[model samples]
Target: MATQVNPPRGMRDFLPVEKRVRDRVLRVIRAAYEHHGFEEIETPVVEDAARLHAGLGGDNEKLAFAVMRRGLEVDDLRAAAAPLELADLGLRFDLTVPLARFIATHRSSLPPVFRAIQIAPVWRAERPQRGRYRQFMQCDIDIAGEPGITAELELLAATGDALTRLGIPDAFIRINDRRILFAALDHAGIAPELHEAALITVDKLDKIGPAGVAAELAERGVDGERLLATLEAIRAGESTGAGGTLHGFDAAALEPVRELLAANAGIRLEFDPTLVRGMGYYTGPIFEIAHPDLPFSIGGGGRYDGMVGRFLGRELPAVGISLGFERLVDLVSLPEEEAGETVALLVDKEVEPTRAIAIKRDLVAAGQTVRMQRRTKNVTALLEQLAASGATHFAFVRPGDTAATLEVKPID
Candidate 1:
């Protein structure tokens, strides 16, 4: 008996039609990024385990697909008591970490402010569900060496434009600042040490609701009431009547981002006091792309001013936004007819093979998707094959005295 073969769990095999849809979506995304002056770049799918464990990826660090040391165990591993000691490299869980390493190594050769577009697959060891996979594609755009809020604005605009191009309607951006979050925690009497615990809880507000998040925070030894009060105070500050500053929350820090969002058409930007994305590297502004039809954010990213500096030995402010390519493909279905019109050339075996090849080349050069096949004895079988090929217009060809003449007709 032969062993059965299958794709690994949480992975998929994309057939021709499925691949076409993915490619079309990616083309739209790439065009949007390129139009905004972002140059495309690629990084390796794997990275040093140390870089992945560098505390920048937040929860994604735990989900990294680690690769074991190939030949010999290091001295650390030879005497180690744990299996994790054997890992020297790991598959990248996200594009940002590798981008940081890329920038650190290539800084002198690159421009001062670099806008990059990276579209690639990343691996994670997570449970697979609809719109979630262990091996998935991330479409990322980042700006390095930009410390101002304009980076955030441009990221949001380009991302929003991409979604719009993909025919996603009623898209909105939920905006927040890490500075505001920390201040709210402080005003709520949460100690510096407990801020992370509280932030993690608050990040689940949409998933579990306000009461659920508060209950979870209390279980984690947080003062839930004070935290809720602090959140309210921050929201109050954003309102029309509140004073310039409340509870040390700097509303001014977000004013520029807010103004930019307001001016952009088709963008419904709102101040989300609870939008604490799990990534610890976010130093300033944070945002999530929201749609009316979905309960979860389709995409998110924020300012990670300290991430690249972890490698570069100096402060390098950067901001990035990621489009959830897989999730978007799930939400937006491409029409079957949009794939392309396939043209099938049924060539008689008696016809000169060179003529058939030449016709195929000509049709291909003219941008028609042409597939050449030898004529079968049964007309019905030939039609079946053409139908299976998804050929919209099929033709029967015979080498004439002068040229190959085609009797073309609709597939139907």
Candidate 2:
């Protein structure tokens, strides 16, 4: 019997071509970020289990992959009060929490106001589906210690530049504030405790529409039709303040956010009163990137003025945006691995090794991507194989052929 082999469920293994494209896309994204003066940083894939469960990662904390302790006796397991108690560490579910911890550990070494970039894989124990995965990459840029909307503007501009460079189609950001959401709930006569439940339904407004949200909210003992109408009015740039619906909402709460929205953020920003990121730590404006073709967002982030402070023992402001790398990979249409004129150096089996190396060096020095392959039985099949793998040109090396004398032919 043959054994069935596969990567872990919800995980993936990229083929050579797929990997090449991914690297290229990553490079483009990195360049865009660096152009905006954001420096890249790295953190351990695993963090202390306590930090992972620190109530800052929102629902992502629930999906963290716990790493059990290295040495646990049977008695310890029996004595354990909770499953996670046996685990000392967990794979980080998102980059933000780790970033917060990172700054706390490296505060003295970093600048007072630090702009950092992190591109890495994070693990989540999710029920994998089309766009969701157990293991996936997140590209995040965060500004820490700058206490104003400048950080938000910088993140938006930089993220927009990356999207532009990737040529993401019809991408826009929907902006909202936690304050706005709470005010909407309050104005709708929904109890404070039901705010979370109402926001959950509101986030689905696009998919379920007003009627559906009303139905769902009604089930929770709150009629939300008026709430949805008020949100719609806000979305249309109409103020409900004159009608007394925006009560408990400090107009100043939106002053800075309005300034952020009005800035030339380098991308379209639509104020959404119903937008809720579900991250409990978001203390201010939150946003998500939307595309015309997709039912879901590709990326988003917002201010968490309270998170970093929790780690550093004092409140420090921080905000970041993450590009949903997996979704971006699906949406991006890039030319497969175009690294200039690639040359396949087909060396005859009898050719001297030194001679082939010398020839390859010359082609490489000429700025061509060079790959040396021993001549095979079926030369045409070999050329086709090379061409399929992104070889654009080919050169033959025989016993006496010099690098200067060899003819380089186009693969096609």
Candidate 3:
């Protein structure tokens, strides 16, 4: 009996149709990131265990795919042990941490306020469910060395614009400042010391509702009155009096954010009070984008001002966002069959290599995705299979022909 081969749990193999849609999503995002002056960069999928540990915070430590080396002596340890620590140098969890390390290592070569875009895979050791995966790609854009709110706003606007251009016009970019969230917690009678617990609870507001959140808070030692106050404060309507008097930092502190949102006339922008992102590195304005039809966020990111400093020993303010490519694919209706035209190349056994190449090139140049008929079937059989596979056009090439004739037919 033969054993069946399968992809590792929580990982997936994208079929041709799925790959097309995923590629489309990536192309649109890459174009958008480049338009915003973000230079593209690549980072190693594996890093030194020490650097990975220092850059990715505590929660991620458990998820590191640690590696060990064998078959090498202490004298031969240098050569043999090089690849052994693949586990120690776990797969990157996200692009931001790697970007920070890249900038710090290449500080002299990079410009002040460096802008970069990275598209790569990240791994998480969480249980897999409907939309979540253990390994997935994240499209990220980050800017370092600018601490102003305007920088944050620009990222928000760019993110909104990218989604809008991708046909998710109804998507909302929910924005919130960590400072504002803290201020609201302080007002609710939760002491600054318990703020992290309060944030973890409040973040679940959408998932479990107010009662569930309150229960969670109570478990963390929050008093009933204080928990209710916190919920009500966050649920309070948008502030009207410049900075609404919840926290000492008046509307003036929030004006830059407010103004930026107001300027974006097309996209739906909202100041969400409960948007406490799960990551620990975020220090300033944080945000997540949601679509009316999608149950999960399509993308999110925030300011991590101290990350660069962790490596470079100097504060370099940065903010960025990532687009969930797979989630976006889920939201879009598959392309209409009629809208997609595929060309099938039917080659005779005696066809010369040069002529076959020319025919394929011509069809591809005419904006068609070409698939060469395999030797598994005769020409007639290949043609029948191509028709069944949704190919609308076909080209038959004979040996030594200067121009291959295309027998175009539309499939119903």
Task: State which candidate has the highest TM-score.
Answer: 2
State the lDDT of candidate 3 residue by residue for 57-154, as single tens digits.
54675565655534435566554544434334567777787888899999999998788889888887768888888899998888888877667666
* lDDT per residue as tens, model 1, 1-412: 9886878889999977678789888988999999989999988889999889988898999999988888764676668676657888999999999999999999998899999999999999999887778999999999999887677778877887898888886878888888778877877778899988889889888788878988998998888877887777666667655634674555565565456555763457887777889999988888888998888788999999998988999989999999888889878764554557788888887788777788888778878798878878897788876776577888888766112456667788
**280: Cα error in model 3, Å:** 1.0
TM-score of 2: 0.88
Q: Where in model 3 is the C-alpha error above 4 Å?
A: 55-58, 69-87, 234-237, 240-243, 247-259, 262-266, 333-343, 347-370, 374-392, 396-412
The Cα error of candidate 3 at residue 103, in Å, is 1.1
lDDT, candidate 2, equals: 0.86
lDDT of each: 0.83, 0.86, 0.73
Candidate 3, residue 392: the lDDT equals 72
**Model 2: runs farther than 4 Å from truth?**
236-250, 335-338, 347-368, 396-408
Rank all candidate structures by their lDDT, best first, as comma-separated numbers: 2, 1, 3
State which candidate has the highest lDDT.
Answer: 2
Q: How well does each candidate superpose onto the true structure, as a TM-score?
A: 0.87, 0.88, 0.82
In angstroms, the error of model 1 at 212 is: 2.4
Please tell me which model should have the higher lDDT, number 1 or number 3: 1
